[model samples]
Target: MKGVLVLENGSRFSGELIGCVRKGYGEVVFHTGMTGYQEILTDPSYAEQIVVMTYPLIGNYGINGDDFEAKRPWLTGFVTGETCDFPSHFRQEQTLDQYLSEQGIVGLTGVNTRSLVKMIREEGSLKGYILPANLLADGEKFDFPALPRDLVRRVSTKQTYQHSVQGESHVVLVDFGAKENIAGALTRLGCRVTVVPADTEFEQIARLQPDGIMLSNGPGDPADCADLLPLIKRLATAYPLFGICLGHQLLAMSFGATTEKMRFGHRGSNHPVQDLRSGKVWITSQNHSYSVRREGFPAELVVTHKHVNDDSIEGVAHSVLPAFSVQFHPEACPGPQDAEALFHRFLALMNERKGSQLVTTI
Candidate 1:
């Protein structure tokens, strides 16, 4: 069926419908990665959003069984310049079109994605709808739904789950629409991972006897989770903590820092981030619409890393507390894995803390 993307600002773009033939609506944003369509699609952070792929040709390698970051795709719609129907990869299990159609996901193809991305860059991400061209051309008045404030609640797990690695150290992960690889990465580092709901209380966490706490990446404005900040501050004080993406923003917010939405957020695989302490730069995978503000940066925290492109705060560490965070994903699924070593960094911090406790007891 023919379809058109109707933006709230009266912008309309037409394309061919590929998947489930129903209208799709949500915040429309673009990603600049050349691959990792599967990871991008399944990431819970993309919940209630319509993703536009900037790369001209996507799904060339096909979808594999191992690459999904979540059990299901959370983005409301998928938009691309062209989607491959016949992908060529040894591990390929299904084509992108077949998977999208099977999953009841609505996708628009043969779109002028470059033009669409250019508009988004200038005007910022917008809430929009993908409907049949006829329905749009026929002058039907449709009320687009406002972006929901409870995106994190919708995507977060209702129950705590364990991904046991049988390692000596235990890390409790506070899920805020977390990606699967966040747990996978931790387990691979020889850490037993326990995942809890976003609303899990600190007392509940204290019972888990975690050596460290990991604040997973999530969606929506960090400020919307004002209630979580108190718990986050409490967690940081008691445990060696690490935060990623949304977690990074919340960690800063918990320490008197502020956050603001980017005009066009970072949503790609090759973002360059510089480590200020080491003068090292790493190509990172990032997907978020908000960042910690430099204006009211908390005195208790020190800037550790920054984005090379925009000078946005990328990493921070608390001076007194053994807590740190990074705005880019260290557990990149279909992207770079260099930052995966950050998990070991967290483990070392946990070990150091454990040694200190043993000494105190002695």
Candidate 2:
């Protein structure tokens, strides 16, 4: 079967269908990670988007059940320069094509993925459609799926859930399509985590009496999630608060800060960021198309980290509050660990707060 990718700009590319033979449409984006295709595919951050892998070959190790970041692959479509037909790895359970098809994901191979990536790099992200070239070549207009405005709602869990461990501090996690590592990292740090839905009410969350709260990374436009800002504002003052990625954006907004979309956005593992306070540079992993607008930040909040590439804000801290956030992934599952200590930083803040509260009670 033939696969054709039609960009919103009307550019088209032809390739061979390798996974589920079905039409799909989404905002086309590319990832530069040479590894972690499975993690990227299942990452809810990719929800409602079509992903083009920049690496020439994919699925050399096949797919395993243990590495999924989301419930399933949320990407609307997949494209690759070449795909491995046979994979050899001890953990391999299924081939990439088999895995994607089983999950009802559409994939295209034998396409110039490098060229596609370059196009996205130059033009920024855009909506596109994928279908059989035979169906597209004759000038038939394929109806593109309505670009989703509520991507976060579609990806977020409807009900609250929990991940518990025997620990001193109880952390209430506001799940805005959180990555698994966020909870896993907390568990490793001697914290009991209760994962809640994105729209969890403040009164209900307060009843948990958690020592801290975490705003999680998620997909889509931050402005689309206006419903969460009030809840975040209410929770921030109730406990020690920390956020990451979309969580970071929401935190900024809760303090009356603004956000803006990037030209191409950061979506790779090799991004360089500098801790403004420590003057230390760290290679980090990042994956968000929008950023908190520096101009919109309140004076009460201080910029703590910045992207060395474009001089964009990477981290922020409140002047008189035990609240902070970073726009990068510190719990990177398939990327660099330079930012892993950030999880420790959040844990330390919680520990400090617990001590202060104990002292006050006495």
Candidate 3:
């Protein structure tokens, strides 16, 4: 069936409907990753966004159950230049079309994705809709509601859960729609992970007596989560705290720093980030729409990593507090694994704090 993608700016592209036939709408954004469609589809960070894959061909690897980042796909819609109906990977359980259909997501195939990407790059992110070609010709107006501010709440866990129970260090993950691979990564490092809701109070967290705290990646504006700022501030003061993506933005805001929406935000796996301490650049996986603003940044926080492309803040560490954050995914499911060592750095921070407490008690 024919489908048409209409941007808020009045631009339109007609293509074949490859997934569900229903219309979908959201802020239209593009990702440059050549692979990991499954992970990107399931990542909650893409909530309320219609994702356009810049890669000319998608779904070549097929969908596998093991690679899902979240329990369900959260993007408002999917767009691709071309989609493979038949996949060739051995672990493939089903085609991407089938997966998106099952998840009630609309997808457009054979689209001029390169052109859409270029437009987004030049005009910034846009709110758009994907509907059947018939709807476009029917003269019926199509308008989507404004994206909600409660995106994090819509995606975050409602209850706390545990993972990697047998691991040594106990870490509480404030799950603002966390990817499962993050817990998997910590588990691999012998850390017991307890995931809590986005609005989990500091008192509840304190009762867990966790050795470390993790602020997880999620969807939407960091300012929308103002209710959690006090909790983050309290936790950062008392524990070894680490954050990623949205969590990084929240952490910065907790310290009186501010965050701003990016112009066509970074959403690729091949971004280069320079580690300020080591003076080395590492390829990173990133997916976020907002970033920490440099003006009036907190004095206690020190820049640790920066994006090589725009010199944006990619990582920061508190001068005296055992807290740090990064805007990129170190757990890289479908990207280069070079940044995995950062998890080890987190582990080292936890261990050092533990040793100091042990000495103080003795």
The TM-score leader among the candidates is: 3
Model 1 agreement with the true structure over 1-362: per-residue lDDT tens digits: 88889898898888899888888899999999998899999999998899999999988998889988888888889999987888899999988888888888899998999999999999999899987788866789867777888678788888988888598899999999999988988888889999999999999999999999999998898888998999999999999999999999999999999999999899998999999988988999999999999998989999999999999999999998999999999898435566877888999999999999999999
* All models, RMSD in angstroms: 1.3, 1.4, 1.0
Task: Give the deviation of candidate 1 from the true structure as CA RMSD.
Answer: 1.3
Q: Where does candidate 1 have its weakest 10-residue lDDT segment?
A: 333-342
Error of 2 at 288 (Å): 0.7
lDDT for each residue of candidate 3 in 17-88, tens digit (9 for 90 to 100): 977889898999999998989999999999999999999999999999899989998998999999999899
Per-residue CA lDDT of model 2 for 1-362, tens digit only, reads 88889887878888998778888888888888888888888889888888888889999999997888887878889999999999999999999999988999899999998788888889999888778777765878755656778677777778877787678889988888888878888888888999888888899999888989999999999999987898888888878899999999999998999999998789877788999988988887788999988785799889999999899999988898889999988888445576777777777888898898889999
- Per-model TM-score versus the true fold: 0.97, 0.96, 0.98
Stretches of model 2 off by over 4 angstroms after superposition: 143-146, 333-336
**Candidate 2 — which pairs collide?**
none
**Alpha carbon lDDT at 220, candidate 3:** 93
Question: Which 10-residue span in candidate 2 carries the lowest summed lDDT?
Answer: 333-342
